[model samples]
Target: MEAAIKFEAHEEVVSFDQEGNVVVNKESHMSKKLMARRAIEAHRERKRLESELEDYYFEEM
Candidate 1:
């Protein structure tokens, strides 16, 4: 027989992953959206940096 898990009325559900980090099972929609937005921002920053480097090289020639 397995023991039943319980939670307090006001407690939020929490779990852990393989790495032992605290994982929140809720707010999936918000988290996914935030992750995607961050990824796009990182990509844009990388491209801007690359463009600046290229311009610098061209100017020196």
Candidate 2:
């Protein structure tokens, strides 16, 4: 299997390439889509953590 790495910008994947090689324009679409998905997932995780912290603080009060 080829190891893949992605570069993202502005919530878009600007590039995706196998390790040790450069990615070109053709790979940009999928890379951007993956980047967007990852970003959304990260946002959700942050929200969950904040909610948990709020609950914890309230319980301790």
TM-score of each: 0.51, 0.52
* Model 2 stretches astray by more than 4 angstroms: 1-30
Q: Ten residues in a row with the worst lDDT in model 2?
A: 1-10
Clashing pairs in 2: 13-32
lDDT of 2 by residue, 14-47 (tens): 3334542333344454556765666566566666
> Which candidate number would show the highest lDDT if scored against the true structure?
1
Candidate 2 TM-score to native:
0.52
The residue-by-residue lDDT of candidate 1 on 1-61, one tens digit each, is: 1232223322343444686444554643345665456556655666699799999999999
lDDT at position 51, candidate 2: 95
lDDT of 1 at 40: 62
Model 1 has a clash total of: 0
